[model samples]
Target: MDIVISIASKIAESLVTPIGREFGYLIYYDTNMKDLKDELKQLFEMKDRVQESVKAAKRNGEVINYDVQSWQTSVDKLIQKVLHFEEEVSMKRRCLYRWNISRKATKITQDVLYLQKEGTFNNVAHPAPPPMIWSTFKEGFKDFKSRMTHVNRVTEVLKNEEVRMIGICGMGGCG
Candidate 1:
């Protein structure tokens, strides 16, 4: 019985940690895309509830109930979907980057041809616009901003200044 409980605890920890990490990434991605935010938010909430249920079961020294298992299964499926969505987004970004590079190269070639035909390189009035910003760093920062807002709200409710300071510092470091 002891071994069984230990194994269950380990399994729950392993599953919960990855799910949380994946949910965090999904949230970060959704910050700019906004397409998956609502669905991911629902999954996150469900994960939280499932985690609470597991904790409760552990505290009571009871085996996880069927309802908890069902919740866990649903969360697992949602996480898988989120991962698939991320992969699709990455592929799309790569294709867009290639397209942008090709377009810029073609424009540069045309400009050079015109310069050669006109026999003047001195009258170019405007430089090409900067390449499309492909990195998702901006979206990630927006996600961080939202997380910071939550941290601030939690800190405001904390009675201990030292603890609040630590929490804020911890969140900043994570960012």
Candidate 2:
């Protein structure tokens, strides 16, 4: 008797859980869309504010972060989704379709919220990294006495009119 009761309870709980969740989605479909619309609006505002910062960074010749660029692309794609959803809503939509649309709106709303949190860019853009060639040569270059003598000889060789071609060989690095 005890084993039978336990099995019954488990089966009942599993059925009840899914039914309850589906019912919630169906019942709150309109509410979900409204909340999603409001969140999307706020997301747009946040995106605009961030865009201003990106613009400022560009003007100052700072390189934008990869994450920030990715976020912008995501927002752009979301705008299209919202537009498509809006058109669908404006048309004659069936009650059965409500759940699907509601689910989509809920997902997009959550995405917008996630994006808002990620939009916080304390370091939106950073100073661009120096070119590798510069770092490899100029940055680590030292004016050693021996190196300077080589430099003088190279310059004299270059100044000679008969010298059509020249090559720099030695340390081949900052040395």
Candidate 3:
């Protein structure tokens, strides 16, 4: 029973982790895109309102009612802040996507290592399982190390890219 449970747990974990990671990536992408779209709609609506207010104030010989102008300015600033936040979230989502890829790669590499370690090649004597076992372990470790390094590199690249994108968007007021 203990052995059964242990095997069952490992199997379950192997199955669940990838699916969970994938689901998380999908959810982040979906939610961030939705938020971005909503923010865009809000920006447009704010612009339209600003135009209408200016037109009304102009027709009445006042470009803005002082009190209303203050409120509009505050709302505009808030909207700009929200757009910035959305951009941040989008950047995070991209990072999450990359992280997901790294995680899956690591998982596969580990699974191969696990199977090889469990004597999966014990029966084959023609090619000498000793070299196969040694090489597999060595290669698996190398892959693991490389994957970790790539994950860090990917994260840094993403951070820099996000900063550049934010700067560009801020300058254009198009976020």
TM-score of each: 0.32, 0.70, 0.30
The ten-residue window of minimal lDDT in model 2 covers 132-141
The local distance difference test score of each candidate is 0.53, 0.85, 0.50
Clash-forming residue pairs, model 1: none
TM-score of 1: 0.32
Which parts of model 2 have CA positions greater than 4 angstroms off? 129-175
| lDDT tens digits by residue: candidate 3, 1-175 | 9999999999999999878967665555545445445545554565565557566556655434454455456556555655565455556546555455444334433433332233222111122124233332433333366456656765776778445532212222111
Residue pairs in steric clash, candidate 2?
none
For residues 62-167, could you state the per-residue lDDT of candidate 2 as single tens digits? 9999999999998898898889988887774788788777877788888889888888777789998776663556464677887788889999999999999998
Better of 1 and 2 by lDDT: 2
**lDDT leaderboard ranking:** 2, 1, 3
Winner by TM-score between candidate 3 and candidate 2? 2
Top model by lDDT, which number?
Answer: 2
What stretches of model 1 exceed 4 Å from their correct place?
1-33, 93-175
Cα deviation of 119 in candidate 1 (Å)? 71
Clashes of 2: 0
